[model samples]
Target chain A: MSDTSANRRQRVQSAETGMSVLKALARLGGDASLTAIAAEVDENAAKVHRYLLSLVQEGMVAQNAATQHYHLGPESVRIGLAALRQCDPVRMGEMALVRLRESLQVTCFIAVMGNRGPTVLRIEEPSLPVTVNMRAGSVLPWLWSASGQAFLAFSDDADIRVQAQAEFDAGNEAQRSMLAGPDPVARLCRQVKEQGCAIVIDTLLRGISAVAAPIFDARGRVVAVLTALGASNGFDARPGGKVCPQVMREAATISHAMGFGPG
Target chain B: MSDTSANRRQRVQSAETGMSVLKALARLGGDASLTAIAAEVDENAAKVHRYLLSLVQEGMVAQNAATQHYHLGPESVRIGLAALRQCDPVRMGEMALVRLRESLQVTCFIAVMGNRGPTVLRIEEPSLPVTVNMRAGSVLPWLWSASGQAFLAFSDDADIRVQAQAEFDAGNEAQRSMLAGPDPVARLCRQVKEQGCAIVIDTLLRGISAVAAPIFDARGRVVAVLTALGASNGFDARPGGKVCPQVMREAATISHAMGFGPG
Candidate 1:
C-alpha cells in the first residue's frame, strides 16, 4: 500500500482498537479496571487507561472513587434506550410471543435480521418441563434454522442479503455449503410465500423442529419473524404438530395487528 | 492558569467538542449529515465533518450510500445494549412495573436516582382512558416527587445522596429550597419510611397525585422507586386511589422477589 493509504489504515486500526476497548468494558457488565479491560481486549494497560479516562469524562463510563473501577454511566443507558425506542420489531413482537407461549405451551421467539446475521430479539419459553430453553440476543446463521430462513425469505433488502452471505461464507466449510447458492434466499422466499411458513426439521439441532412466519410493520415492511420451537420426535406423531398451524395463524394475526394485512 | 493548565484545558475543550458532536447526533436520532450536525451543535462544518469521519471509522456512526447522512452504527447499539444489560435497576424495575400495572389498574413507574435527578427507568400505563401518560425515560426533580422521596428513604449510600443533592440544588431557587437542610434527605427518608410510601401532591405536575414505594435489591441496596400516578382531582374522591395500597404491596412483593427483606 502507498504511504498515505498505510496512514489511513493505521488511523482506522486505532479507532477500531478504541471502540474494542469500549466494547470490552461493556461486555464485562459495564464495570472494569484499566488492567482488567486491557487483559480482556489484549491491549496495553496505559493506552486502555487513557481511553477509559476519556470515556469517563464524556459521561459514558463512571469510575468508582473507592474501587477505581469503571461502570456504564447514565449517558450510556440513555443512548442505548434511544436506539431501542426506534426498534418497532421488539415492541410488536413481545406481546405476540407472550400470547403464543401461553396458548401453545411451547417456546416462542422473535428474531430480527441483524448486520451480522439473524439474532433472537426475544424468547418466551412456556413454563413446561419440555420447553425449549433458548435465550434472547443469541445469533444464528441465515441457513441453519427455521427462524433464519423465515427472516431471509421476507427480507428483500439487498444489503442484508450481502452481509448475511458474507457472514455465512466466513463460517466453516461445511456451514458454507449449506448457505451457498446463486439465489438461495430468493428460493426460500418462494417457499415461504407458498407455504405461508418456514419449517426446519433438525437442520440446526437434532430432534428439534420449528415453524416460523414473517411479521410486518405498518408500512408492510418485514420487521421480524416469529417461531414456535418444539421437539421433532413427537411433532408429526402428535397432530402433524397440531400447534404449528395455530402458531402460524397467531403470527399472522400479530403482523396484521401491527398494520400489515391480507385484509 | 499556568501554561500546562492551559494545555490541559485545551484538551478538555476538544474532548467536550467531540462529545457535543456525538450528543447532537444522538439527539437527532442518530442520523445527520455534517452540515446538519454542524447546525445542530453550532460547530464549524469542516470540524464537524472531521469528527463525523472519526466516528465513522470508530463504528459509532455510518454513512448511508444513498443519502450520505450518518446513522448510528450497529456497534453503537451494541455498546448501548451492553450498558443497559448491566443496569440491574431497569431490569428488576421493569418487571415490577408490569406486575404493578396489572394489579393496580393504574399507571406504574420505576425511577432511579441519577446525577441529573430522578430518571424514569420504566413506565407501564394501565389500559384506562384517564391513566397517566408519562413516558419511560422522562427525568424529574429529585426533591419534589414521590419517586425521589422513596429513593432518599431507602438509599443509605453516601455517593448517591451527594449526587442526588447536587442535582436537586442545581434547579431553580424555589426548587433548590426543597432540597436544602442540614439533613433534608434524612427527614424525607424518615417520613417515607413511617408512612410506608411518599405522597407527592402537586409537586411535579399540577393536578397530579402520586404515591411511591422503594424497591431494594438482593443486597438490601435501594435500586428503584415504584410509583402509582393519577390525576389529583378525582384520585382521593373516588375508589381509584385505593390502588395505593395495592401499589405499596406490589412494590414490596417485587422488592422481595428481587431478594430484599424487612430487616
Candidate 2:
C-alpha cells in the first residue's frame, strides 16, 4: 500500500483498538478497572488507561468516584437509544417476540448480525419469567447457538461463511475435527435453509436448548434471527416441534412487518 | 489555572467537543452530514470534519456509503445497551409506565435528567396505542414539560436550580417575566412536592396536557420522573383527576421498586 494509505490504515486500526476497550468494558458487565479492561482486550494497561480517560472525557464512559470503576456513560445510552430507534428490525421484531412469549410460554429473543457476532437485540419472557442468559445487546458466538446457525445458514451474505470460518479457526484445536470440514457446516446450512429454521441442544450452555429462524427484509435479505429458548429437558428442537414452528412464524411475521414479501 | 492544569483542561474540552459531534447527530435524529454536525456544534467545519472521521473510524459513528450522512454505529448501540441494562431507574420505571398505561388507559413515559435536558427513557401506551410524538431518547426542556417540572421541583440536587436558572436566562424575553423569578419556580416545586405530582396544561405543545410525579431512590434522591400525557380535551390535568392520582400511585410503586423507603 502507498504510504498515505498505510498511514490512514494505521489510524483506523488504532481507532478500532480504542473502540475495543469500550466493548471490553461492556462485555465485562459494564463496569471494570483499567487492568480488567486491558486483560479483556489483551492490550497494555497504560494504553487502555489513556483510552479510558479519553472516553470518559468524551462521555462515552464514566468512572464512579467512590469505586473508581468505569462504566458506559449516559451519552453512550443516548447514542444506543438512537441506534435502537433507527434499526427497524429490532423494533418491529419486539412486538412479535412479545406476542410469541405471551402465547408460547417460552422465552423469545431477537438477535441481529452485529459486528462481533449475532447480538441479541430484544427479548420477551413468559408469565413465569424463566431464567435465561440471553438479553438485548448480548453477542452469542456462531460456532454453537441456534440464532448463530440460523443466520449462518440462511443469511444471503457470502461473508457469513468467511466470518464463521474465522470463528471456527479461532476455536479450540480439539473441536476443529468434531464437525470435520466446511462440508459439515455447509450441509447443516442446506438443511436449515430447506427446513426454514435451526435448532441446537445444549450447544453453548448446558441444560438449555434453542430454536431459531432467519428473518428477512423486503428484498429477501436476512436482517435478523429470532429464537425461542428453554430448558433442554422439555424444549423441542424438531422442525415440527411446538416451539420451533412458533419461532418461524414470528420470524415471518417480523420479516413481513419489515417490508419483506412476495415482491 | 496553572500551565499544566490549563493544558489538561484544554485536552478534556477538546475531547468533549469531539463527543458533541456524536451528540449532535443523535440530537438531529442520528443521521447528518459533516456540515450539519459542525453547524449543530457551532464549531469550524474542518475541526468537526476531523472529529467525524475519527468517530466513524472509532465505530462510535457510521457514515452511509451513499448519503455519507453520519449515524450512530453498532458499537454505540452495544454501549447503550450496556447502559440500559445498568441503569435501574429506566429499567424498573418501565414496569410502572406499563402498569399505569394499562390500568389508566393512557400513554405514560419515564424521563430522566440527561446531560442536555430531561430525556425520555421509556414509554408505554394502552391497548389502542395512543398516537403521541414523545418517544424514548427525546429531550424535553425543564421549563415546559410536566416530567421536566417534576424533576425540577422534587430533585434534591442543588445543581438542578442552577441548570433551571441557566435555561431561564437563555430563554426569550416573553418567558422571562412569565415565571417571574426563582420564587415562582420554587413555589411550583413546593406544590409538586406537597402533592407528590406536577401538572401542565397547553404549555409546551398545543391541545396537550400532562401529569407527572418524581421517582425517588432509597436515599430519597429523585432518579426519574414519570408522566402521563394526552390531548387536553379528554385528558384530565386536575389535581384530583382520574389520571393524576393513578400516576402518583404508579410513581410511588416505581419508587418502591427502585429501593426507596426504610422497609
True contacts kept of each: 0.25, 0.40
- DockQ for all candidate structures vs. native: 0.10, 0.16
Model 1 lDDT per residue over A136-167, tens place: 88887666677877777777777766765665
lDDT of every predicted structure (CA atoms): 0.67, 0.75
Q: Lowest-lDDT window of 10 residues in candidate 1 chain A?
A: A1-10
TM-score of each: 0.40, 0.40
Chain B TM-score list for all models: 0.55, 0.62
Candidate 2, residues A1-263: lDDT per residue as tens digits?
Answer: 12365446434344456567777888787788888999999988877776777677666786765577887766666666666567577765767777788777788888888998899978888878657776789998776888998999987677888877777778776445545655667877887888889887776778888899988864477889999988888777778978887888888876754445421
Candidate 1 DockQ vs. native? 0.10
